[model samples]
Target: MDICHEAPVKCLAYSPDGKWLATGSEDCTIILWDSEGQLVQEWVAHAGEVWSIAFSPDSRHLASVGFRREHAVWNVMPGQGAPKAMILEGHTGLVVSCAWSPDGTLIAAGSGDKTVLLWDARTFQLLHRLNLFTLEQHAHAVTHITFSSDGIRILSASSDGTVKIWDAFSGALILSLEGHTCGVNKACFSPCGKYIASASSDQTVWLWSIDDGSCVETLFEHRADVRHVAFSPDGMTLSSGACDGTVAIRHIRDIILVQDTDM
Candidate 1:
C-alpha cells in the first residue's frame, strides 16, 4: 500500500481497539493510519529514527522511544500548538522498547542500559527500577520486557542470552532461564500468563512454563535468527518473526503449522 511521506518504515503498532495503526520510520516521524490503511495524522515523532511505538490500552494516547533514549507519550487525536504530552528520559543508554502493563497504570521500558524502568502513566514519575545485573546474572543490554497477563510479573530478555522473570511490583527477579547460545532478543508472556516464549539469535524459540521456570517446548524450524514472538490474543496460536524474512504461525501447544507466511 502507498503509506506515507518519503521514508522507510522501522516499526509499526496497532491501537488497542484495532481501529488505527501507527508506523514509525527512518524519516524521524510517525504516520497515523486508520484501520483501512488511510493516513490520518503525520508528524515529527522523534528526533531520530523512531524505533518502537505503542498505543495506550485506552486508545487515547500513543507512546514512542527512539533517537537515543528519548521517550514520549502523545495525545492520539489531531493537535496543534503544544505537544499533546511530555518527553520522558532517564535511561543511561538507548531506549530499546516500552509497553503498557495489562492494568494500564504502568509503562514498562527496557533499555540498552541493561535495565527495565517502570513509570506512572499519568504523572510520568519513575515508579520502579529493575536492574538486570543486580541479579548477578545478566551482563548485557536488556532488549525487551513484557508484563504477565496477571500484571504481577515481568519477563525480560537480554543480550546476555537469558530471560528472567521478576515480581512486577517489587522489582525482584524470580527466575533466570539460560538456554540460548546467543543473545535473547525478546521474551513475551502468553495472553493467559501461563507461559513465556523467548526469541533468540541462537535460531530457536523456547516456551517456558512461567509458573515453574521450566522450558515446556522449543521450536527450531526457522534456520536463522529468531527476533520476536507473540501469542495470539486467544492463546490458540503463536506468531514469530525472524531475520530469515519470514513470519510463521503455529499451534501454540504442539507447534503445528496453522499458517506460515513469508513477509
Candidate 2:
C-alpha cells in the first residue's frame, strides 16, 4: 500500500474514530484518506511545509502546524470538496508539534519560539501562552508537546536536552526530566499515565517515572538520532523510530524485568 504525495510527507495522524488518515506534506498540502486508502479530500493547508497534524479526540476536526508561524484546525467531515479550516495566528516562530487533549477541549502546540500555546478546540481561540523560558525557562526550542491520557498534565520535549512536565490546567511547570545528552525530540505518556517515554538526539529512548520524574531505563538500540517514541494503547509495549531508518518495539514487561535484575 504505497500512497504517494507530490512532496515529502512530514507528518500524519489518524482520526480518533479510525475512519480517516490525514497526511501533511512539504508540498504545503494535506490529504485525507479513507481506511481503504482512497483519497477523500485534499487541500492546501499552509504556506510552507506542514510539520505536524493531530486529530481531535472526537474525530470531527484535524489540527495542523508547520514552518508557517500559524496553525490551522479543519473540519474534516466526510463528503467535502475542500474542508473548512480556520487559521490560528500568534506564534512568532515555526510551529513544530501539536496534540489534542484527551477530552478534546484543547489543542497544545510547541514552536521554535520556545513556547507552548494551548488553544480552545471549539472556538479556535488562544487559551494560554506557556512561555517555557519565562516559566521553567529553557534555553532552546520546544520541539514536542502532548497531553497525559488523564488530561491532567502536559509533557514537552525541547532542543535543550530536557523533558518538562506541566500542570495542564494551571499551565505551571511541574518537573524537568533531565537526562538526555542532546536535544529531546519527542515524548509521550503511557496509556495508564504512569510513565513518560522520550526519544532523544542522543540516539536513545528513555522511560521515566511520572510519579517522581526519575529515569527508569534508557534503551539504546537506535543507531542515530531517535526521532519519535510511542506507547501502545494497552501500555504494555513501547516503540521508537530513529534517523537510522529503523523502528524498535519493546515489551514493557521485558523492560521491567531488566530493571529489576539491574537493581
Candidate 3:
C-alpha cells in the first residue's frame, strides 16, 4: 500500500479496466504501476505539482492537471512509454482538477482562475470556458469537478463555500448548493448520479440531492478539514479523508435512517 513518490503524492487514479494505477506527485512526475504493483512506467509530467489524474472510460487515455496552468493527455497502453498526446493550455492559473466524461468525449478542468474549461477529447480543442466570476457563480478558485454518470452534467467544488451543477455541453448553470461554512475542497457524483457529496474546509461533508439541490445530510466527526469524499462502486457506502489523518466510512442506509429519525 506504500508506493512511495519522490514528493507528496497529490493525486491517484486507476484505469477503468483496473489494470493500471497512476500516481501524480509534487515532484512533477507521474508513475504508472500495474495491478500487481510492478512499476510500469514513469515520466516527468509537468513543471509544477500534478494536481489531478483521471483515466478515460475505455482505459486508453489518462489525463492530468498541474499547478502550472496546463493539463496533458497521455496514451496508456502496454509497452507505450507514457507518450503525451496533447497539452491543453487555457487556464490562466493553476489547473487543479480534471475529469473525463463517461463516454470519453469531453474533458473538464477546474482552475484557480475561477473558471472551468471543457475540451473536446478527440480533437484536443477548446469547447467551452465556464466562468465562475459573476454574482451567480463561485467567487473563488474551483478546486474539484466531476461529470455525471450520463455525462450531461458537471458538479464543481470551489473555494467559495459552494458546489455548483452545470449543463456540461452548453456551459449553463444548473444549481448551486451552499451550506458549508468554509471553502469546498472536493465533490463527487454518486454512482447512480442522484446525489453529490462534497468535502469542505468546514470539517464536514454535505450530501446533496441532485434533483432539488438540497443538503440531505451533513456528516461530521473529522477533527480537521475534509479533503476528499468518494462513494463505493455500489453507491451504498461513502468514504471520506481529512487533514486530521483519519478516514471515515458510512453506509447510505444508515444516513437515511438518521435523516428519517430527525424528520
Candidate 4:
C-alpha cells in the first residue's frame, strides 16, 4: 500500500480486467501492482522520466512514453519466454503520452514534437505520422491521447489549448474542439463515445458534444489548474483532479440524460 518511486510518479493506468495497476515515475521506472494494491513487479522502463503508460485491451501488454523521443511496449505479465519490451522510434521531440486502441490493434503516442504517431499493435511497426499539415495537428506539445470506445476515432489534448478528433484508420482530421483559455492537461472520451471531457490550466473542465463539437457544459470548481478528467465505465459518473490536489467526482448520468432528451 505504500509503494513509491525515487522520483515523482507521473502517470498510472489500470488494466481493463481490473486485475493490475501500473504506475510510471519521473525516476524512469515503472511499478506494477496487483488488484489489491500489492507490489508485483518493478522495472526500468525509460532512460528519462516516464510520463505516460497505457494497458492493452486484454491487460497483458503496456505502452509507455517519456522524456525520451521513443515509445516502448512492455510485456507486463509475461509468460514463458516472452519478450520484455519493444522500442519504437520516429519522434523528433520528447514523447509525452501513449495509448492503446480499444480493440488492441493499434498503439498511439503523443509527443512534444506536436504529432501523434500510430503504430501497428501486432507487428510493432509505424502506421501513420498523423501530422501531415500544421492545421491537422497540435500547435504545441501533445499532452494526452486516447482512442474512442468504439475504436473508430482518436482524441488528442494539447498544450495548444485545444483537443482534436481524428479518423483512426485514414489519419484524417475530423474536428478541432477549442475553448480552453489555457493549455489542456488531459482529455478523454465518454464510454458511449458521444462526448469528450477536457481538463485545462484555465481551472475548469469542459464537456463537448462529439456530434456537433459544441461546449455542452463547463465545470468551474477547481481553484487551480485542472489536470485530469475521466468518465466512469458506464458513462455516468465523471471525475476530475486538479493541481491543488483536489479530486472531484460528480454524478453525470442525469446531466447526460437531460442532454439526450433535449436533443
Give the least accurate 10-residue stretch of model 2, judged by summed lDDT. Answer: 240-249
Candidate 4: Cα lDDT at 49: 79
| Candidate 2 local lDDT, 92-136, one digit each (tens) | 887888888778888888887788889888888989998764435
Model 1 regions more than 4 Å off: 1-15, 18-44, 74-86, 89-92, 101-133, 139-141, 168-173, 212-214, 220-224, 244-263
Q: Which ten residues in a row are the worst by lDDT in model 3?
A: 1-10
Off by over 4 Å in 4: 1-14, 18-44, 77-84, 89-92, 112-131, 136-156, 164-178, 220-223, 239-251
lDDT leaderboard ranking: 3, 4, 2, 1
Best by TM-score: 4
- Over 102-170, each residue of candidate 4 has an lDDT whose tens digit, in order, gives 689998887767787999999989989976334356888777777677778878888999999988788
* lDDT for each residue of candidate 1 in 1-263, tens digit (9 for 90 to 100): 23344554545556767566676766788777775667788889788977777778888788888877889998887544433656886899988787887667888777877787889998989889887644435798676766676668777789899999888777887998888889997788766666788888898988877667777788876766776676655566655556544545566644322211210
Q: Model 1: how large is the Cα RMSD against the reference? A: 6.2
CA RMSD (A), model 3: 4.9
Residue pairs with clashing backbones, model 3: none
Q: Which ten residues in a row have the lowest lDDT in candidate 1?
A: 254-263
**Residue 103 lDDT in model 1?**
62
Model 1 quality (TM-score): 0.65
Tell me the alpha-carbon RMSD of every candidate.
Answer: 6.2, 5.0, 4.9, 4.8
User: At residue 36, what lDDT does model 2 achieve?
Assistant: 72
Instruction: Pick the winner on TM-score between candidates 3 and 4.
Output: 4
